[model samples]
Target: MNNKKPALRIGIIGGGISGVALALGLCRHSHLQVQLFESAPAFGEVGAGVSFGPNAVCAIAGLGLGETYLHVADRTPEPWEDVWFEWRRGSDASYLGATITPGVGQSSVHRADFLDALAAQLPEGITQFGKRATQVDQQSDELKVLFDDGTEYPCDLLIGADGIKSALRNHVLEGQGLAPQAPRFSGTCAYRGMVDSLHLREAFRVHGIDEHLVDVPQMYLGLDGHILTFPVRNGRIINVVAFISDRSQPEPTWPADAPWVREVSQREMLDAFAGWGDAARAVLECIPTPTIWALHDLVELPGYVHGRVVLIGDAAHAMLPHQGAGAGQGLEDAYFLARLLGDTRTDAGNLAELLEAYDNLRRPRACRVQRTSLETGELYELRDPIVGANEQLLGEVLATRFDWLWNHDLDADLTEARARLGWEPRSRGALRQG
Candidate 1:
């Protein structure tokens, strides 16, 4: 007689960093069947560069992508290896402070390059492109993911990594009798562009600005606006994002039909930062064409798990990029969720308890990061009432604001999750052996 259990059918929606990382992590197990559905024809990341903090680095390593990430990740040069960002006043270029996080300062990568690195490791026949999930239907034994191509995929579980504008989000919320929420416009518009590092350095020299600004990651803070620059492509190019806020309205609002991103003239960008210090202008001058992005974040959902359907990454908690921890949070989600689902004790029979454990452990932390990221953006624009323009106070807060976020221990959470699901404690080495 031959008696063997069937593999768990797991379907992941979306193909960005979070979805791909989760897929790679789950694929390590032999008893789990995983498939990823992406809307685009091929895997790609929109945006210039993304930075990860120490906590994110830990999560990446936990997911077994440490070596892969390090191969493409960029860090601040020596002598400033521990500096996250040198903060300065945008008006006069005076130093305000710096965020010093040791060992993993400003570890960033070109979004597309990092995505490519992760996607390259996915097992063949595991991803289906051009599959955009339009709706999710729950049956007695499985969940059905209906794609825009007039096709449906049935799986034991569904994971929504579909980003801020998630279709599965409504399904999850509606199942729980909660009203579906829309993505909230943060009332901030960011102009993004990339510039050649050498050209920016020469501009600094001609403009008599500090050339070190080009080599190291920097944040120029001002009233109602800020500019951020960091190296990508192994220091050959610099990624720039300049932000402008409109606070006239008491509450955040944006038109539902308006395009989120649009092209704008360089002159418009220059005029936005007019009267700023030479350092800020020099970086902006390098980009002849720039795109303006209407920054939007999801309204916090009441929960991330409902039945066999769950959410991850921006689908659950999309936040502003002020803390540079948004992507890191997604990575953390992938790490925790993958570990739970890949645990030896997890099976189709007890999926509810295991997924609930995941929701209990991850929801609080990701939501907190979401809230802090928005606050950090306000602080960068000098809108924080407590630390407003107080250089000493701002410096003190900047030095340690990220300690709780970056110094988190994901292994401990895994242990707690195991206990929650009545599973025996297993050492990291033994868990990997499974």
Candidate 2:
């Protein structure tokens, strides 16, 4: 009689969307035991808005959490109409060419609601909050995680699903005698806020924004800036993001406390849009208060995992939101790595090789989006000929390839991972959802 344990115990750091999504995926494998650690006091995400294209929605659907997402989120099938452009500083608001579509089906949702849906799917007692990881080191045969309270927990593998500002990443990379590179400012900043659709309707003669535009996504281009607006919470709230150029030195990473910053005045915002269209200026006026973000991007790391520790989501790759795949790519990493770790045969020695393969598969796709996102930002912030050229090129070249982005099958990717990495095979008749 062989009486061995059925599941492999794993420790996951970070409890954001990426971490929670990965935990839910691992839970689907009855042979895997997972524990998640979060630094924050509670489970929630920190952004105002998020866009889930077909690719991301498909990933969530595969996790069996799509119904929850649909219940809590505003599900809109239409994408924003072609991005329009006008010179904000000019006397006349001239029409710059518009971009039709980017690729696939897309929808917008409140960031917190999306995170909550992912966290809700986890079984009770699986997540431990208020446990900030202070240090990561190997203790005997297991990976030891030391928290701020002077306590430690040991596990077979430590998954640093922690976000872009990851403490575990610092411990691992710095411990390897490599100084972690800081995120550089991309010469841009963003002012984000949300307003009621009623206020916007009362403010301007909204031409393109109607009932259809509520579900449809829209980006308006200007000289050295662009504004994107979309619906959330069943089209009850409209989320707006204003992007502009910032030539100053890159600021600190987000979620930082800077007490000296003043509120963005209506006057300052109006000055920024001195010559923009009535529509663009009208939307800016409707904003109550805007949170400014000095846009930043990090250089790609050579590897995602070393030893028994692997990186996922923003911890591995952080990109601009121009492509709208920042969260989607992170979700992809979570689903991909969860499947890799579900294999019973995975061990420390071959773990490096497996991680390298994960990087090989993910890096190019991520890097491409990173670069494309930067270019897209540049195109939207243009105030001259670049804006016209970009719009023309986007209509002629870019929007057609969106179908490929929205319709990816993440489950099939997992199936391939099982075969490629020698993971345990499921019985043909027994299919598991999520």
Predicted structure with the largest lDDT when compared to the true one: 1
Compute each candidate's TM-score over C-alphas. Answer: 0.97, 0.83
- Whole-model lDDT, candidate 2? 0.68
- Among all windows of 10 consecutive residues in model 2, the one with the lowest summed lDDT is 83-92
Global lDDT of each candidate: 0.90, 0.68
- Candidate 1, residue 4: the lDDT equals 71
lDDT of 2 at 296: 71
Residues 278-311, model 2: lDDT tens digits: 6677778888677777677767776666566777
Please write out the lDDT profile of model 1 over residues 217-259, one tens digit for every residue.
9999999999999999889999999999999997878887789
Residue pairs of candidate 1 with colliding backbone atoms: none
- Model 1: residues with Cα > 4 Å off, grouped in runs: 425-434
